[model samples]
Target: MDNMFRLMGSEEFSDRRRCIWVNGPVIIGAGPSGLATAACLHEQGVPFVVLERADCIASLWQRRTYDRIKLHLPKNVCQLPKMPFPENYPEYPTKRQFIDYLESYANRFDISPQFNECVQSARYDEVSGLWRIKTTTTSSIAGSEMEYICRWLVVATGENAERVVPEIDGLTTKFEGEVIHSCEYKSGEKYRGKSVLVVGCGNSGMEVSLDLANHNANPSMVVRSSVHVLPREIFGKATFEISMMLMKWLPLWLVDKLLLILAWLILGNLTKYGVKRPNMGPMELKVVTGKTPVLDIGAIEKIKSGDVDVVPGIKRFYRNHVEFVDGQRLNLDAVVLATGYRSNVPSWLQENDLFSKNGFPKSAFPNAWKGKSGLYAAGFTRKGLAGASADAVDIAQDIGNVWREDSKIHKMRSRVVYRRCISLA
Candidate 1:
C-alpha cells in the first residue's frame, strides 16, 4: 500500500536535474499496443504508468478464447519492436503461449505495472492542462482509489472488449438453450456429442467451429456475407511474414488488392463455399466499413467433410431452434455468438466530445484536431491486431516531439486535413 501510493503520487529527482514526476504522463492498457507504447516510453526515459483491469497484461487474450486458440498472424510480424519471440514456439503462438510472451515482455522491460488497477474514469482538466485519471485498485487495495494528472492519454483499449451480440427477436422470452458470447468461451468439451450453432465467420467464429469439430460437437456456422480466405502459409512461409515485408515497400491499397487477387487465384470461386469476394477496393483501415475476409482455418474443409455445417444468417430463434434468413430452421442444443466487439470507453472521456459519433476518436495524427489541449489517441484503428505496434512507433515519435516543444508540430497545422472520406458507391 505504501509503495503503490508513493509510485503514483510522490516524485524523486534525478542527477541531471530531471524532475521525474509522480503523475502519469501517459496511461496505457496492458494489451499488445499498450505494451509496445510503454516500452517505447521507457526507452525514451518518459515517466508513465499502465493501468490494467485484469491481474496481468493480455488478460483479454487469456480470458476470451476457446481452447486451441492460436494467433492468426505469425510471431515474426506480430512481435513488439526489438523483442524477438522464443524460437521454440510455433509460427502461430497459442493463447497460453502468447499470454506468457506478454508476461516476459513486461519483465524484460522492467515494466512493473500496477496490477488489478482498473481505470474507472479519465477526464481532461482544462485549467491545469493535464488529464485527471481516476482508477480503483483491486481487492488488495481494499477499494482505495488513485488519481493521476497526466500530460497525455493513450487509449490502447482495442475495439474488441465490448462484444456485439445480435439482437434476436424474442430471444429472452423464447430461447431455452444456453447462449454464450465468445468472450465467456473457454472450451468445447461440454458439447462433445451435442448440436451447436456457431454464429459469425470471422477468425474467432471459424476457430471456435474448428475446436468444436475436434471435440465431436456438430457445429454449424452461420455466414451472413462473404469473406476473403487466405491460407496461413504460402510457399513455405507465414502469410503475415509476407505481408509485413510487402507492406514496407508498397502502399496499403496496392498491397490489399494484390493480396486479394492472389487469394482469389489460389482459393478459387469462394461463393461455392459460403465465402464472398468484397465488391469494394482494397481493404484498408481508411475504409472502415463492412466486414473483411476471413483467414482460412481448415474449418471450411471440415464443413465439406460433414463435420460442420454452413448456413445462412439467423433471423429468429425458438426453444432449441434458430431460423435463418432463407426461411430455414435448424435444431440446436447451444448457440455461440462469435460476433465482434465495440469500444466501451468510460463516461469521463466520452462527455468531452473527443470521440466521433461512431464512437471512435475524431482526430488521428500528430495534430488530429485543432485547439484541443494535450489529449492523444493511439491504437484506435485496426490494421490487423498488430496495428498497436504500428501505433507505438508513430506515437512515441509524436509524443517525444511534442514534449521537446519541436517546431515541426506547427508546420502541418494548415496543410494536413484529417477528414473522413465518404463512400457513395
Candidate 2:
C-alpha cells in the first residue's frame, strides 16, 4: 500500500491533491462484481486497486437490502468467478451467507479495497493517456482528498448503485405514515398487526408483503402495471436453471411459451387477484428491457389467501389513508416502496460515449463489457451475477494481454539500459 500511494509534489496538481499511482486498473466498488473482477485479475497476475465508498464490501447487500433478501438465483449461478459457495449453504443463500461468501472471496484473492473512499469524479486524461479519479475519504482518518491515476478503469459498481423512489401525489405532505424505500427495510417485525402499503410488485414488493403477512401485518400491495410472476421452481427443478438450459436448444419465443405454460400450471390464473400478465414473455421482456420477473416463493399464496390485499396504483394519499386510481380508498399505517434501485454511474464517471444517460452500457448485452479508452464495466449485465462473472473473466484476460506485452517491452528496455551503463563504465 505504501509503495503504491506516495504523495506527489503540490505543483503536479491543480488543487494540490494527493496522488496514488495504480500499476493496473482501478476498480470502483467492492461489491461482488468488483471482487469477482479483482479475483480474475489476480489469477492473471495483475495488480489492481479497489475503491469503495462504503466501509465494508458489497455495501448494497451489507446495508441497503432488506433482511429477508436471498439470492434470487441458485448458488451456482450467483457464485463469483473463482469461488463457489460453501457446501453447507442452501440453494438460495440468505443475505448474510452471501456477504460471508463475498468476504471469503476477497480474502482468497487478497483483494483489500480502500473503503469509505467515495469517488467524486473520474475522467480520462487524454494528455497522460490515463484515468484521473478524484475521491474523498470518509473514515476515522477522514477528510483526505486523493486522486488515483491508472492505466485502466473498471466500473464494477454494478446496476443497483442507488435506490429509486417514485414521486406520488400527496404521499409526503398529506400521508401521515412512515415512508421508506425497500432498501431501508429490514424486516416486518415492528409493523405487526399494523396496516402497511407496499408499492411496486417486483420481487422485493412481493417478498416484503409476504413477510408483513407472516408477521401479522395487514399488507396491501400496489400492483399498478402488468407483471410476470413465475414459480421459482417447476417439478423439483429451478426455473432459472431450466431457462438457461433450454435457451441453448430452443428459440427464445418457444422457451417463453413453455415456461409460461409451466407457470400457469403451477400458479394458475393470477388475473383474478389483479396481477396482469405482460404481452411480452418474461425472458423476452427481461432481454428487451432490464425488467426481471418475480420468482414466487411464498408471496403468491399470501396474495391468494386474502392476507395481502392487491391494490391498484395510488391516486393520492390522505392523512392516514390512500386513494387508489380505481376510486377505492384504504387506510394504512406505513408505506414500503419496493420500487427497486438504479445505476449511479452517470453521477460520477465523466465518460459520455461508453455509458448512456441512464447509467448503463450503451451497447447491448454480450457486447457491453468493454468501452473506449481503457474503460470496462462489470455487473451492468441485467443477466445478474453469472453475467458479472463472465465480464470479470473477459476483462482480466483483455487487460492481462496488454499488461504482459508492456512488461516484456519494459524488461527489454531495462536490459538495454544496463548494457549501456556497463559499457560506459
Top TM-score hit:
2
Span of 10 residues, lowest total lDDT, candidate 2: 1-10
Relative to the true structure, candidate 2 has a C-alpha RMSD (angstroms) of 2.6
TM-score of every model? 0.81, 0.96
**What tens digits encode model 2's per-residue C-alpha lDDT throughout 22-44?**
88999999998899999999999
Query: Residue-wise lDDT of candidate 1 within 172-222, one digit each (tens)?
Result: 679898899988878889999989889888888888898899899999998
The regions of model 1 sitting more than 4 angstroms off are 1-21, 138-142, 241-261, 281-291, 351-354, 363-372, 401-425
How far is 343's C-alpha from truth in model 1 (Å)?
A: 1.2
Question: In model 1, what is the error at residue 69, expressed in angstroms?
Answer: 1.5
Candidate 1 positional error at 18, Å: 26
Error of 2 at 245 (Å): 1.4
